[model samples]
Target: MSFAPYNDLRRHCAALGFGNQWTEAACALGNERFAACPHGDYPRWKAALDGLPAVPPAFRMREGMPCLGEDFQDQQGLADELMTFHPWRKGPLQLAGVTIDTEWRSDWKWSRIAPHIDLSAQRVLDIGCGNGYFGWRMLDAGAELVIGVDPTWVFVMQWLACRHFAGDLANFVLPQGIEDLPEQEVAFDSVFSMGVLYHRRDPAHHLARLHSLLKPGGTLVLETLVLPDDQADGVLVPEGRYARMRNVWAVPGCERLLRWVAEAGFSNAQIVDVNQTTVEEQRSTPWMTFESLDKTLDPQDSARTIEGHPAPRRAVLIARSA
Candidate 1:
């Protein structure tokens, strides 16, 4: 079956100077990837998405956070339906009278970086956009269009479920990655790569890819895990899992990350925020019942991961394309 959201994305991109040919090809690529998704929960997640209650255009943040709640007669049913897509890691999505308290308080990250970038009338791209939580916030910040890409099947389903209620929204999330886009396309005015850099085995290559996505002098907001100041000029390549995530490859200090951004060909690669992640920012919520930051850290010393590496400290950098 054809993905309705992809159709919407194609139409939206057509009007945004991406041209009909690029839209067609990009959406076709997304469709082929979706068709081949091997996730076991894809069927159930798609069913849940199809069953979401129809609502009007009620996309707004509640008390400075992204929310999609609307008055629904069957509130319990709504809760049950949304729970099928468990492990909601990146949001505190308030959906149809039921609040999904996700693992990460993603709004906190948005607050730290939002003031630095001007999303107003900008075409934005978010790589590793878990469930498109940040994309909604980007639209709220007045972005002309927000296109988020992640290869995870369940996250794509989660985004589709959220988009079903958003109603003709300009923000879209594709089941693709930064590598999937053509090199030096330079289509977006702002590009965000949050919590994704460390996962790449070659982070410099990833930064270069992000640089290629932005237009000349366009802004790039990057947030990723970093080591402490004492480890400046040092990069920790975890022997195994770091903070319970196996994909985490490298965690460099703030200075080293700034250097990496500079080497990637971005100018004004300066650090805007550096804060160690806390349990309050990431914890087990009803929406995410699995192991969280608390479990992954050394109980005796919060300063270290269970694997004894420096605990997760993230840094947000704002750079401009050269």
Candidate 2:
């Protein structure tokens, strides 16, 4: 898989001069890790990328969706080629006149958080960035550069698909996780960790790492599943699967989460928006033909998961590092 956009990102940082040494190092490591990747589907994803017809990289963002390429001949063929990489989880993206109505209405997610943060000329690190969907919104919000890390090779391929049409935009979604990247304490002006907290065994530790990644007085935008304060324990350590997700460990109450954030050395931690996820927000579409949120909910009680846990209610917290 040719990670040309990532390489272009490295070059862009290098051209900016000596201050971006750490970024350069991370970029190099990303390249190395990507090359050494053992994912079984990497070749398939790469082949899909190879199959993308080169219409001019006439990309733009409209209403938060990353629109890729101009309308060309063989529109149905382009859509079919895109369908090769099935289960597109993070988008409702536009590609060569094909509107891929993806599983998640990611534009809504971006809309929720975009109003709370100012990314103008900021350097950002997005952990678990899922095909870098939010990276486009971050750049659109005036972020100077956005580096996103995700472990899934498929999402990286999705990002590559966008890159093929968009050329080298400042947003780069590296095929690596936050844990895999080289350490650069205080490297970012703003850090975002959305929908990734509960998956970790140590929520506080994860917050701490997010704290450490930011510059002095830098912003931390954290979003994760939360149990309602009045309805559950301080932290709900799911005895079994929550919402059909086996990896989910702890989902904190509003107060408990804020306390954890404060304990992790973030100050002025405040909930910006809290919303119970609806089926419309995440459901199966033609582009992502698989079980989705609709299947995760309890049939008898939509407000509860199949395992009887409270249905997904996510909270967005904005705080600052000392």
Candidate 3:
């Protein structure tokens, strides 16, 4: 793994005068964890990046969100190289002339949450930020810096490959999780935990940790799978899997989640939006060749999962640390 980018990040933090425990911990974690993890695809991804044709030092969020191709290189070859890192879950990234139509239209989710937040000049932390796709959008929206953390090494490689094309900036994704974050680091202006809460076996504990990571009065943006209004008082602990995802632990109602937020000591917790995920939002594409939302839902009834649980509905909630 290249520690050059991590070194650059350290320099960037120093230039910004951000000498906090979070910065120190992040730099340490990035250096240690990323170098130690020996993912099977790491070398391949690195080789692809090394072989990538040089592009102009420019990237913009126009056309679609966070696109590359200003310098324009071997279009088909670059696309083929990018395909080696398959099963793309987050974005619809456009290379020089090829468009990687990813499984999830993440831009829609961003649209739902972006209008409600004040991101300009904020130092943000995005948990479970797959490939740092949203981090680029956050930077484009005027955020000062975005610290994205995810434990998946494959996703980290994908983000690195993307960074090769997008050029260096303030966005940095550490190959770590929320648990890897240092406790008592209250430096961020905002923290986002999208599609992460339900995966937690202990939602309250997770919420408390999120609260602890933020400064007093810092904003928290949380998005997660949810139950509908009828099940507002109930929390669905799936017997096995929900929507073919084995990690799903708790699917709570919006009100129940708000209560969890309040119990975690966040103020003014409210649900901003609720949208049922459709095939249009999440489906199989060439870039991501796997069973998707369509296959996860009941063929007989789209309103239920294959396991006979409620269909997938996601909610966005915003709160402030007290």
Question: RMSD to native for every prediction?
Answer: 1.5, 1.7, 1.4
For each candidate, the alpha-carbon lDDT, in order, equals 0.84, 0.85, 0.85
TM-score of each: 0.96, 0.95, 0.96
Ranking by TM-score: 3, 1, 2
lDDT string, candidate 1, 180-286, tens digits: 86442446789899999999999999998888878889999999998899997889999989988999999998888989999999998889899999999999988
> Model 1, which residues run further than 4 Å from truth?
none
Error of 2 at 217 (Å): 0.7
lDDT of 1 at 310: 94
Using lDDT as the yardstick, the better of models 1 and 3 is 3
Candidate 1: TM-score?
Answer: 0.96
What would the per-residue lDDT of candidate 3 be over residues 1-322, giving only the tens digit for each residue? 4554577677778887775777877878788876666787777877776777777656677654688656465777888988877878898776555577889999999999999998999989899999888998899888988889999887887787777777778888888888888764557899999999988889999999989888899999999988989999789999899898999999999879889999999998889999999999999999999889999999999999999999999999999998
Among residues 3 or more apart in sequence or in different chains, the pairs in candidate 2 whose N, CA or C atoms overlap within 3 Å are none
Alpha-carbon RMSD, candidate 3: 1.4
Worst 10 residues of 3 by lDDT: 63-72
lDDT of 3: 0.85
